[model samples]
Every structure is written in C-alpha cells, then in structure tokens.
Target chain A: MQHTDNFQEITHHHDYDREASRKEVIRVTVILTVITLVELALGFWLMSIHQELMRHFIKGLICIFMLAKAFYIVGYFMHLKHELRNMIMTIVVPLLLFVWFIIAFLADGNSYKNLRNKYDPHHVEESKTKVDKPVHGEEHGAKKEGAIE
Target chain B: MAQAVPAEQKWWSGGKSPFNVEYGKLMMWYFLMSDAFTFGAFLISYGTIRFSSNNWPDPNEVFQSFPGLGSGYPLAFVSLMTFILIISSVTMVLAVQAGHAMDKKSVIKYLIWTIIGGLAFLSCQAWEWTHLHHEGAWWGSNPFLNMDGTKASTNFTNFFFTITGFHGFHVFSGVIINIIMLIMTINDVFERRGHYLMIEKAGLYWHFVDLVWVFVFTCFYLI
Candidate 1:
C-alpha cells in the first residue's frame, strides 16, 4: 500500500490506516441499526402489553435505548473506543450521573403527588369554613338566612 | 517544541495514550461524547415527563403527515424525512471513503449530495412543525382528547418541540459546515494544506446528526 509523505503523516494520525476506519464505520453503523430496531420493538411491546406500562415505563426504556445508541456512536464511529480510559470515563460517568439526577427529581415529584393524595384528601366544607363572609351582596344575605335558621 | 517526538511510531499498535488514540482523534471522541450526552439529556427529560403523565398521545397518531398524499395522512412526511437523513449519512460515509482514497472529485460530489440531503430533511421538518402549529396543537394543550379518546398531554407536545427543534438546529448547522468544507476541497485548499483531518472530523459530526435523527424517528414518531 502506498503511504503519504512523513510531513503529511505528522499532523493527521490516520489511526485506522484508511481501510480500518472505513470498515469500522460500516460495522458501527450496522450495530446502531440493529440496536435501533430492538429499541423500537421494545417500545412497541411496552405500549401493547399494558397502557400503564407505556405511560410509566416506556419513557425510561427510551432513555436507556438512546443511551445505548449514544454509547456505540461515541465508542466506535466517533473513535472514542480508541481514546484513553480516563478520557472516556471523564466523558461518560458524569453523563450517567446527570441522567440519574433527572430521574430522581421526577420520581420525587411523582411520589409527593401520591403522598398528597393519600394523606391530605382536601375537603370542600373544611376549606369553606375558613372563608370570611362578604360584608355585602347575595352571599351576605345567604349568611343572614343561615344566622336566622 | 521539545516534546514533539512522535508519540507512537508503530502506526497500528497501541499507544501510551489512555485510550490508545492520538490527541486530535481523542479530542474528537470527547467532543462527540459530550454532544451525545447533551442530546441524551433532552430526550430523557422528554421521556420522564411523558412517562409520568397519564394518557399521553401516541406519536404515530399525532405525526401522521403522509408524503405526496392528501394532507394529514399520519407519519408519512416524517418517515420520508427519516429516510432522507439516513441516505445523507450514507453520502457522508462515501465522502469519507473518497477522502481516504484521496479522490478529490468523488469527495466533492458526495459532500454536495450530503448537503442536499440535509437541506431536504430540514424542509420536511419545517412543514411538519407548521402543520402541527396550525392545528391548534400547541405544547401541553390538554394531552388527552376526551374520555373516550386517548388522553393528550402538553408534555408530549413540548418534548416534540424542544428535542426535535434542537436536533433540527444541528442538521442546519451541519449542512452549512458541509457546504464550507465542500467549497474548500473543490478549491484544492485541503490538498494544498495537506490536512484531511477536517474532512474526517466533519464527517463524524454529520454522522452524529444522522444518528440522532434515527432515534428521534423511532421514539418521537414511530412509537
């Protein structure tokens, strides 16, 4: 195989030596396609089995599928698979934590809504008792009738 | 300049570098990694809200714009857009291959095709957005239809806007970059400069835009 001059080689790494990056990109693309299909299938299955599952679980599953696709793209096609261990971790670990933070926040909000439903069933009469009667108008007339009765 | 000694001379072998890649390629990897995370965050937040809510509208039911057919045929328009984006990714691969073979003409042709593909995808998206906006489908406008119909949530609509809008922005910028790089290559600028790394890096960026669209089509439209 013919090689470029040394000066030309100095600036560009050409790590895959031409043939390899070409082959690697195709391989990575195929992997991405397959994973995408599986994720779509999983999404369909989730939606079909239970309406609640689709509402509650499908979103999380989509996130996981997206994360997987992102991993392969970065690792292979973007050539992160060829980078330093520390650099790879530096990029990935924090992203994982960031996603976790979002999930936790959403979960807490959901649980708080549930707890409010369970512990504090708001009642209309209890709320009405605290309202001050109007000094004038139909409501005040109604209050007078209540006082008479 | 003293540390300019070549780091790894083996060419194909592993390096002392942490991921065994050279600095330029490693940085590209890191940039892509961060970019992936940014996209992930947007899509995941979309998922969180849509999941937490009840009776969200199905994507297929909402984005049913058919291509070359009567208006409002579900998902046809966006499906065509998805196919166009995938084909653009193929063109990008061809450009990279031409770069590897040092074939300037082929590289320019493929890049031009890729740019066209990007533009076509953007136009489709613009149409879809306009149609949705015209239909009174503003974000978070009662995600459910009625008691008998599927419950609609604004969360779904909001995500449909934010994530897809951000991705559309990326594709727009990608086309601009491809055009610039194409012009430079055809003028023999890259050849004279003896640097095809820019072409390769730009190819990665372009592919990423394509990759994200694939997921968006599935999660946001198909599912």
Candidate 2:
C-alpha cells in the first residue's frame, strides 16, 4: 500500500510551544489534584453527618465537584476545548440528553417505591424491621429455609 | 494546503475535514461519546433501583477496608485509586504533548508511566473485589445490611460488581492499547510516519477512561 505523503495536507496542525503546553499541563494537574483532595475531604465529612437533608446537600455538592473535574479532564487532557466549535457541539449536544434521562428514570423509580410502600406491606415491613446480624451467602439462604420451615 | 485556504474559508465545506481533525480522531470522539452513554445507562439504572428501594446499603460501610489496614478507614483506599488514575491521566497528556513535538523518547517514557498507573489501578480494584468476595458480596448476594440495619437487597452487590467490573474492563483495554502504542513507538512506526497523530488518538482514549472513573468514583464511593 502506498503511504500517502499528503497525511499532513489533509490534517490541520496546531503550532506547538513546549514550554507553554507544559505549564498548562502542570496547571491542570494541580487543579485536578486540588479538586480531588477537596472531594475526598467532603466524602470524609459526609460520613459524620446523619441528617437526611444535609446528606443530600453534601452529595449534591460532591456531584458538582465531579462535574468540574470532568470539565478539566475533557477540556484540557482530552483537548476538547481546543477542537473546532463544530466538533465540540457534536460531542456536547448529545450529552444534554442525560439530564432528561436521569430525571425521568429517578422520578419513575421514586413513584415505584411509593406505590410499593402503599401496596406491598410485606416488603415494606421486611425492609423496616432491623435484623440482629446481617447474614451472608449460604448462611443467609439457610436462615431463609429455617424461617420457611 | 491548509495554509493556502482563505482565512474565512467555511470549515463545513465538502472539501475539508469539518471538525478540523483527522478522520481517525473524529471517529474516536464519536466512539467515546457512544461509550459515555453506555456507562451512563448503567449508572442511571443503578440509581433508579436505589431510588426504588426502601433501604440501601451505605457505600462507606461497604468499601471501608484497605489492604493491610484491616478495616474502619472509609474512603481511604478508593481515594488512593482515584489519585492513581488522575496521575496516570497526567502522564497520558504529557505523552500526547511529547508526541506532538515528535519526541519519541519522552512519549515512550510517559506512556510507560500511564501503563503502570493503569496496572496499579487494576491491582487496587482486584484487591478490593477479592476482599469483598471474601466477605460474601457478589452478584445476587449481599452480606451487608442497609444503613439502618434493615435487610439489604442483592442489587447492591449486583450493581457494584457490574459497573465497576465494566469500568475495570475499560481500564484493562486501555492498558493494552498503551502497550500497543509503546511497541509501535519503539519500532519507529510513528517516527517514520512523520507525525505522532496516532499517539494523540490513543491519548484521547486514555483521558476518556480517566473521565469515566471520575463519575464512577463519585457514584460508587463518594455519593
């Protein structure tokens, strides 16, 4: 096969500056690390909290941090920010679908749970009743059999 | 040829690459986009099930053990895994930068680091899985109880294994890809091709794997 020498001709090239690029990489790396450290700290803090509202709020904040970390990785490490606007749009537009996807699925799931709680008393009762010891593997199965008998 | 074009030349015209990227890179982006959805679906389903359940196991309780640390250290081991992946991603970016400069040696060096990072992450995951398995967590089994000590569903272990296992499969493939890139770099394939564009494509993939981990880590460990 003839290796086309026009490989450079069809592709658009960016001017390379090693020093500026290295500094940018280091900057992004530092940002990513700091964000991750903050996230870890939040995760630890979350362990101490028991309030439902507060827990939800902290989880939301962690999700936001996760998105920010994603932005840095894609925008810098993956070079999506440097791509042509047309390409960026092609990638970003489809991702918007996830918002609706998440909302609809979660809403439906919550509805299902509400319905189950109202109708399936057995499931609700079983889930609410605390067990003395969490059973495992064959032991859990054996206990179920004992209960059945 | 690119320089000869007028400054205001339409990028979307039939003659030019619309994204100003080579076809391989464009296709790789599209592929990653599709893969993002695949992972997104898996995670969304997991969320849906968790929402539908009356009670669920706490992630902190489930993933507290570290190798040689016995237990009780919540979020510690997974955080280490997260940093490993992040550092590997940095090395991947450096490799791609070196590729852009046609610096073969630097490219090789960074690629090796990235591969080691990938391997290290996989090993961490392996230890975590083995530890969980020893505790009787697997598909269709849950030795753990809900946060309130109520009976927990098997779905907890089910989704954990499936999603993390899937992500691990991606990392495993990524490591293999880097190895292939390393072998090519060693044989002077990119050197002869006059451009290290292939490395750039592989870099896109490596960074994407890292991107997925950010979500996986948050969903499984943090949230």
- Which one is best on lDDT? 2
Fnat of each prediction, in sequence: 0.11, 0.56
Query: Model 2: residues >4 Å from true position, as ranges?
Result: A1-14, A135-149, B1-7
Candidate 2, position B83, lDDT: 93
lDDT of 1 by residue, B1-223 (tens): 0112345645445333434434565566567668877887786666555444433465655666654664555555665686687668867877877776678998999999999999999998888887666555545432224122433335666677888999999999999989999989989987875556667778888878977886677668655
| Cα deviation of A137, candidate 1, in Å | 42
**CAPRI tier of model 2:** acceptable
- 10 residues in a row with least lDDT, candidate 1 chain A: A140-149
Per residue, candidate 1 scores C-alpha lDDT tens digits across A1-149 of: 12234335444454537677677767767776677666656655654554655545775676677778767755565555654455667766866776576668668656654554466555222222333322222331121111000
The model with the greatest DockQ is 2
The alpha-carbon root-mean-square deviation between model 1 and the true structure, to one decimal in Å, is 10.5
